[model samples]
Target: MNTRPAGQDYIATLDLLRLAAALAVVLFHYFFRGAAAEGFLAECYPLAAPFALYGYLGVNLFFLISGFVIAWSAESRSWDQFAIARFVRLYPGFLFCMTITFAIVVLAGSPLLSASFSQYAANLSMFAPAFGQPFMDGVYWSIVLELVFYGWVTLALFTGLFQKRKLELIFVWLTISALNEFFLGSGAARLLFITEFGPFFAAGVLVHHIHAHGRSLPALLLLAAAFLISCGTLSVTRHWMQNHYGIAVSSANLVVANVVMHAALIGAVLLRHRVRPSALILALGGLTYPLYLLHQNIGYLAINAATPVVGKWFAAVGCVALMLFVSWAIWRSCERPAQRLLRIWLGRAVDIGLARFRRVSTEAQPAE
Candidate 1:
């Protein structure tokens, strides 16, 4: 979505894309392979199951969206402001979801696929395992990837590299990702830099450059390279599908997902002219982060309990509805308030700290 001129922040159509990608993920986990986790769905819902297999592509969709938007967010702001904005945007929803999930899982007595107090403490930082605490849900792995992406973006912003050398940086990033994924193929590389998945993020960044500036032959070439590299590095997902589910993930589906994402993103930019912004759409987008964060483990537990009482189809659909409602409530009650408060507090703190630094600098200047 194109960032409108100042005073026009929200883009309605992109919000719809957010909801769609999140719903695809939920369906994949709940209806398709969801049975594996929830235990009540069984070898059931066969009609819908086959089609849902590819829903994991939603995560890639999400990465693309983040790349576009995060770049937009960073384009004009100081790194301090950018960091604060990202924190308030991400952390509030994350905190609410993590705490809520921990409570639900614990109270339900199905806790700990390996849960413990130390892990719970670690989860507060959102990097979980770094401090030796497990993530409240497995879905958190992507969140960490997002944080790493942000780290790089933040570094770029700090060095003034992002503004002047944006395309060059993307080219370098894509090259590094390709070399890491295809050539080095090191486990540590995948873990820390997550180079295997960097192309998707780079593709989104390249798309943003195209969206903001018009398409150039050079930019188009880079976009093409990023997309192809992403396709090549999909070995991780394919291997995951085969190992975990004992089924091959079709290469055609991988190609289709990539194509669809390119179209969706490009289409958003194209339609930016036609699509008027709406608050409803903005709110819908707001619900997505919370919904994505809260959906997986808790939904599984809900499904397990509700299935016998409600019947499978109704239970699944009903739980989806229930979570939507829950997400809305979280948005209204938890996320908005927390973000507002954190911003106020952080703003004052940054001000105080900066003031102190200025004072100390004046003192140290000595007869200047």
Candidate 2:
């Protein structure tokens, strides 16, 4: 009932959800994962393991939010505005976090997680596979997925294939995703087309379409299909968890997590204008990106060092606080400033390019 025009302003509730997602991921890395003892935290903090066991669900939540937010972001802008906004939003924080992680890993003697120059250089591209290296931090995989999602969005915008043709796009994407994820299980498809993770993003897009366009029958059907596909394909994430953590995640828990995530995301959309936007909401949202980018590898190494000096409980706690602080500092110092400057410069560039294109078009009119 409180829905505003698409892309008019930020949906503040999603900011709160972003904070929750980031915190969930932190908890997941700290406790639920088998690798907790492998790097930082020294040993699994058994005290929190019970509570944190399902925190990995946060990534799925983040993906859902990303779909919704990105769709909303592109709704009322030219391709250039969307591109610049995304670049400024993502890159500076990424560069800072990656560089810091690289330095810390190099300085620390953690060979298992240590970096090579090639790896660091590859990571600078963000799409590290192009340069023949893995992500600088394990957490970066999600961000890579986000970038891939952005690329497709850009293509859709460039071709002007969205809106009038959105349902068709979603159907084709869902079909490809289903084949790759469920039937063919092609890793190449998963990476190139984001087939494995397409449903979640699709779900988010459907939510946006429903919200903005008043939930037409066809859109509702597509939304239902997308949700079911996402729910059905969740086992991919479950299998990965099992393989990595050696922990059996019950199917029921997975269902519940997905269900809750769905409800939460939809509720946020429904409450978009119902909830008052505030500086605090904006601030919290602003910090989530930097927090996520900076938290994992560097935090692990920091925890590994501090755990010895301060003992396990104090070390983990202290390091969590420190990482949060560092994240805030990065947001305030690096990310926000970079976004401002980059947006200004990109605005000028876009204007000049548009001017050039207009002049060329005028020159080519041929006295008509």
Candidate 3:
């Protein structure tokens, strides 16, 4: 979504996208949480299961946003500055969230305590991906992709490639994706680094770049095509079809479908920004992070707590609302303060390092 000029600071369409992704994830987790069908509510309804199947697509949208936001967030910066900013922005909030999740698990009779120290250490460092093992905490696997992208962005910035050869770098990444997914037959690897999703992110960057360069309809159309192809490829996975429609489709065709749909959706949203963001839309979008993290487990927890009274749908809604409220409070109280402190500290540390480097260089200079 295009960032509007300053003073407005509002883009209704992106908020809508965020809200839609959050809902997709919430619905996905609602059915897939535990006990398979979640009893009759899912089994009888049948509609809920499809949501669960498609829910994983939320991650793709996120990758797209990350690509756009990273560039958007750091449009004017030195490499050190951008890296420092990204670190400060992500780590403090992440650590706090991790700690919160840890506390909850311990209270909920965590099996983790019985695990070996090596196992515990692996989790603490977010090492599940390296082991090709699933994690105890459900949301963590997604972070692996985000972190990889962060590393990629940092490397690009350090080499001045982000500034100098941006388009070339994007092409190189797309080539790697095609090679890995098709030639190498490494679907898992393609999914991991979000190599397959790179085009979506590239589209986001292109959105901003084109807007900055003055908009052109033809350029946007090409971007739309790229987005469609990328998303289509992802949608046709065997797991997605079986779980969603109970009918398997060839991945080759699924890829094409995903690409077409993603492009169309993004284009529609981008073109429809004249509409204002309603309060409800903002509320839903605001819940996205908490929904992403807590949807699965919270639904289970809610079902257990409200067993006598609340049913599945009620439990799902209540869990989503409760998690959203809790997350909002945490964001305000903990996340904000932590981020502010991190920024100050990171900036000061960078300044000190620069000063020390200058001092050393001055001492090494020939007498003048």
Q: Name the best candidate (by TM-score).
A: 1
RMSD of 1: 2.3
Per-residue error at 326 for model 2, in Å? 1.3
Using lDDT as the yardstick, the better of models 1 and 2 is 1
Show where candidate 2 strays beyond 4 Å: 1-7, 34-41, 109-112, 361-368
State the lDDT of candidate 1 residue by residue for 217-297, as single tens digits: 888999999999999888778887788777656888788878998789778766775777776776677888888999888
lDDT of candidate 3 over 144-231, digit per residue (tens):
6766676787788888888887666766676676567557757676765566666777676666666555566655665665565475
lDDT of 3: 0.60
- Scored by lDDT, the top model is 1
lDDT for model 1 comes to 0.81
Candidates in order have lDDT scores of: 0.81, 0.80, 0.60
Ten contiguous residues minimizing lDDT sum, candidate 1: 1-10
Q: Candidate 1, which segments miss by more than 4 Å at Cα? A: 1-9, 37-43, 111-114, 365-368
TM-score of 2: 0.92
Residue pairs in clash, model 1: 112-115, 119-133
Which of candidates 2 and 3 reaches a greater lDDT?
2
